[model samples]
Target: MGMEDRCLPGGKHKASPSPEGHLGTCHLYRENSCCSPDVIQDLTKANDIYWNRCGNLSSRCEDYLQQVECFYRCSPIAAQWPHPKRPTAVLAVPFCQNFCDEWYDACKEDLTCARNWLTDWHWGPEGNNCNRECISYGQMYKDGKELCETIWDDSFAVSTDPCECLTLSASDTGFSASRSRHEDSDSIEEPETPKKDSRRSGRKGLCPGSPLLHRLKKNLRKRSVFMEDVEGSGSGF
Candidate 1:
């Protein structure tokens, strides 16, 4: 989208520099600021802080630059957005002593705001400032809002999925069909194996009854045989 079209309302954008205690967006001037000293100073200082903190990191500078840009972009919205919320803490300094941890935290905050704007200002059906097709829109968010043909066919429906959680749209019958096909494929690929009982795998025990009862039965049988033998021999006493 064009830069001018992407401009946020003045009330919604404002950033407060922490250490320097400065308050402003990257657009330090009301007019074009290509050669403005204030604009240049802010950019230089912000870059210095970021580079010092991230110099040792092995990644490209693209992500960092985008994050730094957020202060310029979103700070304006944070400042004058219709909502009466307090000014957002936009870090002017790039590098932190905390290093990686702090960078990750800062990036998340900026990106989150960017993502919201991507939907509300650009991708949402009602969006006038931005369009869903912008590369930056995809970079800032997962999936763009779903643009679906309404059942009536006279109008279209659109909704932004925060966090880009799901790719499927409610209007998509194809998604359901694809899901069913996948499930069928999975079933055909592998059938359930029958389970065996482990308890019956071993040999049977000698005593069907309790150990004590079996021992008693054997002793009684032996004693009766001995008595019968004694009675037959005339030693019944």
Candidate 2:
């Protein structure tokens, strides 16, 4: 997506004022009423454990985890906003994009592990299914904000039901299985060679020929957003 397309309407400088008419900030409008702090805490711990266990496979994975934590920590609106508006959405972009560049750098040398981490975290048994259940909450938080800002600018007049927002279509999820498949086709230029090597090297470690490495390669690719990080740009939402 283009920079203009990714940003909240009216750009970063212009913010919608509060009902009382003060310049509204996310902290001022932060909504966590619907969130169970205990639930978020539990999920946070679960996320940490999952990443720690998987991090053993690649130290670079720690960088990606930082981005995940950033999203989880800053997305109270995603958890609590029953009806989200533009002001709140605009407040969330910078926080979410804060770690994008770092995440991209961490994944550059080990893209396979990065994709596997995302896939397994969301769909693997060890992920506690929180990837599918909780991460979407963060995405909803982002999408809701973007939707409101794009359509309404600084107006709080538009309100979106959080439940409806959460029920995103595959495309709306921002990353689709087909996209993963496309990456698999385009990125894995020599999968056959890797498979052959994996069959011969029964040894462990993240070596290209290892079984674990093979599985990482077999899993789906993650969003191209991380790839943007390679340029060290913080432009993505």
Off by over 4 Å in 2: 1-36, 42-49, 57-67, 77-99, 106-237
Q: Taking the tens digit of each residue's C-alpha lDDT, what string does model 2 give over 1-237?
A: 322112122222212211222212212112211122332343324333454332232454443343233233333223222225443233222211212323344443332212223234445554433333222212333333342232122322222322122111111112222344446422332222133123322222233443323433443332344454554686554
Root-mean-square deviation of Cα positions for candidate 2 versus the true structure, in angstroms:
20.8
TM per prediction: 0.20, 0.24
lDDT of 1: 0.27
Pairs with steric clashes in candidate 2: 89-145
| Tens-digit lDDT string for candidate 1 (1-237) | 222213333333322221123324332222222122333344323322322221222233333333334334332222212223312222122122222233333333232212233123433343233323333222443321211111111111232222211111121101111233223211221111112211111112222343222333343354456656886898547
In model 1, which range of ten residues has the least summed lDDT?
165-174
Q: After superposing candidate 1, which stretches have Cα over 4 Å from the reference?
A: 1-37, 41-44, 47-50, 54-59, 73-75, 80-237
lDDT of each: 0.27, 0.29
